[model samples]
Target: MRKTLLTIAATCMWLAGTTAFGQGKTCEEAAPWSNMAMVMDLASYADGGAWYKITPTANSMLPFSLTELPTSAVQVFKGCNGEKALVMSEEVASGNISYYIESGVEYMIKLDVSQATGSFVMAMATPLDLSNAPDGNYCVKPINASVGMYSSIKANRPTWFKVNIVYPGMYSVGSGFSVPAEGAAVTSVKVKSGDCGAVENSSNLLMPNQVYAKAGENFFCVTCSGDMKVLFQMVSPVASCPNHPERMTALSAGVEVTYPNAVYENYWRFIAPETATYQILDKAPQGTILQVGTLDENDDAKFFCNFENGLMAEVDESGEGKLLVDMQAGQTYVIASETFNMLAEGVPSVKISKDETGVRSVSGSSRDIKVSKVAENEYRVSSYLLAEGAGVYVYDMAGRAVSSLNVRPEGDAVTVKLAGVPAGTYMFLIVGRSKSASTKVLVD
Candidate 1:
């Protein structure tokens, strides 16, 4: 999986071809600097370091890396919004992180400088040559086996991969590997036997230590008792010809969905625009069991929760589909569906909608506007002092402006009793010469 690599920090002060040098290192000083290439001599600071704040380009996969001059004294922390951060130390040298930094969002990188021999360099990796494939498994035998090319742990059993060790010297887990299990480390990586039988010629290699092997075809099986993420590593110099990894194309909210008519299984993805309860309605009678869950960067289902409430249908009866979920903002939700038997026609199409009654604000505007449901399918929009060019407009839950509420000022406050739209909740947008505001109004 090709994820946005964003593990890095830098504050630039460039003079065309000139670089800024620093000695007194402290995060308090570096906190205010803009993201640019910088060099600091941490040898003078002794144990002091600085924090580099980076607000990367939105929706871009920024690949960044850091390399210490002599020793590994850099502790990089990843966090935001005053949350406890996951710290990385060992992966700084000759390692990288790909992150999709949201546009105009600030990320803090705290640098804890320790064993600085003399001086060190820090640079934000920009203009990445992504024409190279990402780091992962390559050149394997038996291309049809699920256990051949980069295998994920299935249950508590060991997974195996056979790599043609042409330039084999040492192999260890790379920086792209994930280890979420508490205290989860490489247990034992050694040669595996053919078929479902005893062990063949095997040599166990513990993690953090690269194992040496002769140049030939080698078979290795990774066995970790506890559940953890693992990947194949080619620590030797022969690792080349990288292919750009396949990425998941995410679906955005508030858009009509296209029904999938696959024979057996169907898959989809969506990104929640905000924290709200969303409904996926089945529009046909195929009796499809809809399942929603979280997908890892590999687009693999990680975990799924029971629906708080979902509509059920009989074998041939129509389904009043309603799968409600509290989706978190910016999180990706995976959707999959299955049925007792495949249906060639009338394979239900799904629709997603959010309840607008509790919708606080969509567009963040400063103008004070009030909205209230008065009668069935009627709403009253009022403003104390309207801007010169202030105009009130009504929009459906999908944000398509349906009607305009023309409010002639009565006195100090301006009120418009408008109705005659479809029965449902609607969002009111007030746009003026100098400002704007959004409010929700419900109609029975």
Candidate 2:
């Protein structure tokens, strides 16, 4: 919306204490309202009234207010070219007013003062543009800690925003603002889903504003009293993770990794070369507490190791803790490290060490399992534990089961054919009634 300054003078004629038409007194002579305060000389105009034109650039809910209007009435007309129709009328001593407006439509506002004396201040709010904002439902970007949007809200008016959810998860939506006048505050924030006209599901979000949202669109309505400037913010747990390949680093066992600067959170991608148990140790400055967790294919929290749990030990005086877990070969995993305190400025450093206790066989069985690739998408498996009802399962690196087949032994070995399977590194597990053996295989 563009801003413009407009001022008009009216010359009135009075005969036998009766009012006459003058400039800015009729529909055709109405001055344009351009988001600025207009001063009126009530004694110079007939009936102590003035007319103004309002034309919006987009569909908006305009909030306007009249100050020091002790004895006044406001009327809104739909059309301007002499075919005027009264749409709304309000009688107020002094306060805010709101009306819905459509794009490219002409409207007129008539302010009448019954006292026929002094002047009053008129203010109108501009429609905010949220096209580039990440929190909007139609926006394609995601919001982080560094990005936040701001807008103003008027008293007794509702501000609407469409919240866009790209990834379904728990999120925090919060607002911060300053109250410049009495009764000026943000009252409530409501979230709704489904049809905007009909409420399918609606809920109010209070302080510590946390909400579980699905991947789609949601409507947010904010109501406030008085006029205030608000800062809107939205954050997700996965916002700190490296979303691209360039931001993520590889993790290998026995290598100590360190970041350049202190960060709230950091992530690393790890692929196991052999099936075994590994221990991760965090070494940082004293008084630093870190939360270690793992993410799944959907980037959701798969597992977390905390000080309260036995999987992770408490930080000692030297600020050292260990997390022990077992990993399978040919499987991928994401490790996430986050700090509880934002004030802590120590950089993150961690080292992963493989346990020398060796791989623990399934069901305590010591059966030897061997897998060898022979042809395209074909592998030969030889296992002593193969028996009736024994089956082989194939899983991709992400631990998603892709194929399963029942095996029929021919002599001592069986040939497994993966016809439609894509070329990738996969884990093959042979399971019987009492025992199971697994091996990693690469398909060309």
Candidate 3:
């Protein structure tokens, strides 16, 4: 009886191989496998299993899937002899599996199954190259472009694109395609500098995916699970304030202008007529967000300060929606205003005026108070106006008070120490009984 069963199995195997099962049953006779090729009806063969060999020309991360697996496991080995199993199926779904391979290495994949009468399809995925894709700009409207060759992202694998950035700033990448709710979500979207060696930043498929990129060639790797027809859009901070003259309004001192009720934010360009401290006041309803900054040659936002709900530290208790900023002569600055709810209602007015408080000038002061850096984190403040128990305060560029101390003048100068203060540009304000002086200092 045992010999009869063995003979029947051998005859079945021979008949299957001669008819529809051409794949090798042993590692030594494994057939060659190529990228994006599908092997159909793999489980219909009478042989217990089949083997296929793969040789990658370049290092790659490949994903393999089975339509209807009839076995418990599928494995990849380092060589045909199966001495070492590099990876095994994790079964993301019932039969889907993925693995990574290196260049110049031979890999043998085995589909382990016993005489199953069912059929299954095996498919492999390869990376899609977009290294030479044209550069995209955030300031311009996005145009749809086809991405992968396959219809499904699961079969297309990861898609890589290069970004040539001329300016270092905050940027965002968004996809026009989305995975179906029934399908798996996108695995990852990564940003790398120079090459695809290491990931510098990653983003989700949803939300405003943002990444801070430097000036150079940056690479992006996107992996998804659904449709492959994706259109990726890159957005920069400049997208908010376009370079058109109509978009950036010119703001002059002492001139008040009514902001139109619009959904988008409004921008104002202010070129300092003279080097002085100026105050920007927003009389826009009760809640509004104000931002002040300058655009570099590349139109990247820099030195920006956000006043949440139009509130600033410089404003007094009675003052609302006011910001005092020290501006330099001949330098251009940008002022942006937006409603708290992202939609403006009624009339919103903004005004820029010179701040003529008793505070000394930032560039040069005619006040009696004088401040000089004595050491790395130490400064000598001298002034006859600084009486006993005078208040000394330090503020950062964002108008936030960092440190404050009360001291008595040591003869002509009082040593003020900033031990924990970080190195940057700061403002020092010294207040006496009836007078106050402020000067800007750079700490190294």
Candidate 4:
């Protein structure tokens, strides 16, 4: 699943393109600069040095400038708004964070830490001066399967974050390899296994909400007890998709969608100025229909019910015998259709009524109607009495039965006075000899 990515910083100067330089002679010599790139084995908890740091093939760190803030600083400004921020991480233990001299003004400058401990670089809106900023450095404190780090800035900006525990399970690191637990509710991911190589090239190219691991590393392994659980040390939310993944076609509108159908007087639907088209699609143990309709005209806005398949299902769309209808707003109309064994991709059709003022539809599918306000404070119950004799029940939203009524109504109609009911929303059910129908209604 793909999600929208948001820029979390405001300083544009930090993001400005900088010429790539080579790593300096040593930490003693280059301690004043930020480390551009490195890969570490976070799983090695035995020795803090077990995590190896690689010098950048070329220096990618943005040099601190005084003329104007770097575009990358924009991220710091946005992080203050309560969104997550990316900070810088160090691979070596003795590296020092050095500040450069600029103008006479002092500013707090640094990366913002994410919920995960990993450091990220982003642009910030505020221009921070390093010349007078406080002099404080931070480091990652490692513990077995537990992540911890400390950070501080000259001012109130959140400069540090850390994870308390890291996963310590064996996992398989390869393409198309997934390490999900059985029945575990999958909420988010930081990487896809197949795209490991791309992550190495550009750390920002990983997908959001994915599980990721370093390529060619022991991504997964088994415990001595033979129980297997995938262990991930830490994951960053920064996702980079170079290909610009495909767009998802959501179910905006389509036929055969699972929905309640209650049209006028139990017929399918009818039309006048509107158009509708219904076709029987699948019928194995049961028969299902797919209907597509549109508006015919802008003036006429009422739907009719044939009472068989449907009666005059008129809508605004132009065309004959179509399901789509355009009716004036705010009109009361009645639609009727049968309930099904289960709510599959198919449901009963919707019914609308025609009026000169506006159009209104029936109160959807109702197996039973829990009348909350039949007469002011008093309430009555009713439902679509399709079967000759059906058991009807009414309940509140809390699943408590409000009333019970047996019905042998005259042709799909039942009117029972609910005595002393409160004003609220209620649910109703109509149970046939074997099947049942249900719907909700509000009583003012």
Candidate 5:
């Protein structure tokens, strides 16, 4: 969906008052939840007659008090078998809500409270994992929000190997391989001539890569007489590797081996060079999920995604994260379930450099730009800069600003600090005494 700031604001308002939405398919549906992608909404309510945002713990239950229950809080429920359930007690005064989801199905609960009315109606601002629901039946009888579930990803094949030939010249054929996520490990790489004659067998030579695919086209040698196919295999004990973020199924392929003294960048663009499309992918920890609810005031609920807790992408209620990423025209992306909130909303782009000519040296004074997170509840902001006194902040998909540091001209070096931050994309800005220059940074 093409989200706008207004849309986010509206969603937040909805969450503040009530909670409704689940993350996966009903028993009538079948799929591995949302493939590790997610779509989220916000909500809020009053507590002890005082309004505050509610944060769910790893256990799938909400902390509540009779003194905090109000008519403005919206409550949602679902069946244990992934079936949609009705709101048992329509009154917001009810202190607790419930749901029932079946095994193998994922559900998302949303609570938007931007409106503080004492009543709420059943409405869906967004759908969680409805597209790929598993087959079954279930009901919602008031499930705890803190319950945790174990989930796994089905192994497939390698994605692709993107090899960029930096040096330009001649290329030859050697041995190579690729690996899929949590499958088998490559043991060796071997190349052969047209008649199965061994051309190269690699035992001492080692390729550090685990996975690779062709970006566009494959390469071949000009002197090769006929077509030659390279074969690869891997070995691994069943369940030898635990559920690891970096584990993968490994394979190998043949590449044009360059001479020891050759000066060339010519290389083959190998596509699907692995046994299959089972590449290493990050999965959410057991019991991690997103619910749609609002603050006590019926305002939007604000939350963040964290790798520390298995959240891949997070953004504030302003839809700023969607803006930071390059969006496509007509592609689907996961928001609150998995896949770092998959986003295929815009056309893919590559940053290119152009020749530049300007004053070689420029000098200016130093100034400290004070910055802090919006709240202790806010996600870590990854990068912060002063865009002409207008601070430009960057956060992870989890909505935490990863970097926030003061920047000012001091001699030739610009002052920058990257503390308490994780590796990800970031935006930076520096407002000079008059103009401002903004740039992107990759903290890898």
Candidate 6:
């Protein structure tokens, strides 16, 4: 069921004699001595207020205060994208306010002093320093850090950091993943070069990585709203990360290898010598997961199969993290651990194996459904074999949604019209009530 969030303006009306939309005694209307900008940092004080504006590129959660005690009632307001809303007005007022600021919007911070005296104290500090994180780099394993975004709403100050690597190898940050906001669809946790540096200068083999870890100084940070904490740990590297993973040596079929569990996350490059469907088998202790994905020429991993996270093809129910994948020979495949929120447990060794038989990349679920372009801006979807309804969703190479259509079978197939779309290559994902299938389409 879909629930709509009700946002009622929490405004207060304070008037001893006169009547107006705003309080009779406001910080802006009161004498200069009545309102003071005591501080501009949330890491220090809990009482004070300041004018805030949305950061240029990112969303901000500006923190502020109203009164020290719930002794009076006055209406407080917060703004978003230059629009203000009644934050809260209560008989007792003493608490913090978090303003969800939109980029490019200027907002005002005012106190209500009609029913009771207004307190002025605000705390918002920069880079909310992590202990011993000079130059914003943490050199040790299981490093924890916080990017204080809730207090830095008016400023686009992203918590930045670099790892002082004692050794050089591919690494991955584990556990304690930072969330931008509750219920947000997408968020990123990554490592880059020195503070906010370019991707190429990153010490890790993969820039902006989520699962793959690097053992080098690849700086790590998160871009999101609210205060967040992330955990970092070094990971084993696949020997190949020179931008082109395909050039790396490929693992032969039917080979089982014992890898150390010391590295929580491990990466391996597998090159399919021919078109085939393959299963990656992990015989490690229970709960050890296996992730596999195809990398482009630039070594960028696509939405491959992740059995551990249950985001892709289903693995065995025993929870050992076995995954099936299909790809052409010469394709670069990289596999990593999808561990979250915990350290690697006792696994004597990670046993890895694969069996393959050449086939197409279609799923057994959507085998009855087929999508193909019959003409420009027009495609044909046939689902005569399906026992249920289906829909087609278009997505870009990076997995961002382009559009979707609720397709009904006209006889044995349905025709979909997608006009005015620019020329490009996109992945077409077909969804049934219970199962789904995906295929790539080139638009001209």
Candidate whose TM-score is highest: 6
Name the regions of candidate 4 deviating beyond 4 angstroms. 1-378, 382-429, 434-442
lDDT of 5 by residue, 1-444 (tens): 557888998976665533333222222221222112112232322211111121122223222222223333433223221112232123345544432223343443333334334443233221223224331111111111110221111122111111232222222222224223343333332221111111221222354211111111222111112222222212222110111111212212222121111111111111232222111111222111111111111134422212232212222222121111221223111222211111222221111111133333222111232323343323322222332222233444433344433322112222344665666655443333343333334565
For residues 348-414, write the lDDT of model 2, one tens digit per residue.
5878779775544322122457888787767887777554335566665533357655443213456
Task: Give one digit per residue, the lDDT tens place, for model 1 in 283-311.
Answer: 54333345556543433643332222322
What is candidate 3's lDDT per residue for 120-218, written digit by digit as tens?
Answer: 444454532222333321101112232222123342256555656553345554334543545544556555543333224555446334554434566
How much lDDT does candidate 3 score? 0.53
- Cα lDDT for residue 214, model 6? 33
TM-score per model over all chains: 0.24, 0.26, 0.26, 0.19, 0.20, 0.31
Candidate 6 residue-wise lDDT at 123: 26
Candidate with maximal lDDT: 3
What's the lDDT for candidate 5? 0.25
Task: Using TM-score as the measure, name the better of candidate 1 and candidate 5.
Answer: 1
RMSD, every candidate, angstroms? 22.6, 25.7, 22.0, 28.1, 24.0, 17.3
lDDT of 6: 0.40
Q: Give candidate 2's error at residue 75 in angstroms.
A: 58
lDDT at 359 for candidate 4? Answer: 32
Native-referenced Cα lDDT, model 4: 0.28
Inter-residue clash pairs, candidate 3: none
Clashes of each: 12, 1, 0, 102, 157, 19
Query: lDDT of all the models against the reference?
Result: 0.44, 0.50, 0.53, 0.28, 0.25, 0.40
What candidate 6 gets wrong by more than 4 Å, as runs, is 1-61, 64-103, 106-238, 244-267, 271-277, 281-423, 427-444
Per-residue CA lDDT of candidate 4, range 254-359, in tens?
3332322211112122233333322222211111122222212224443222212222211111111223234333322222222222222333333333333333
Candidate ranking (lDDT, best to worst)? 3, 2, 1, 6, 4, 5
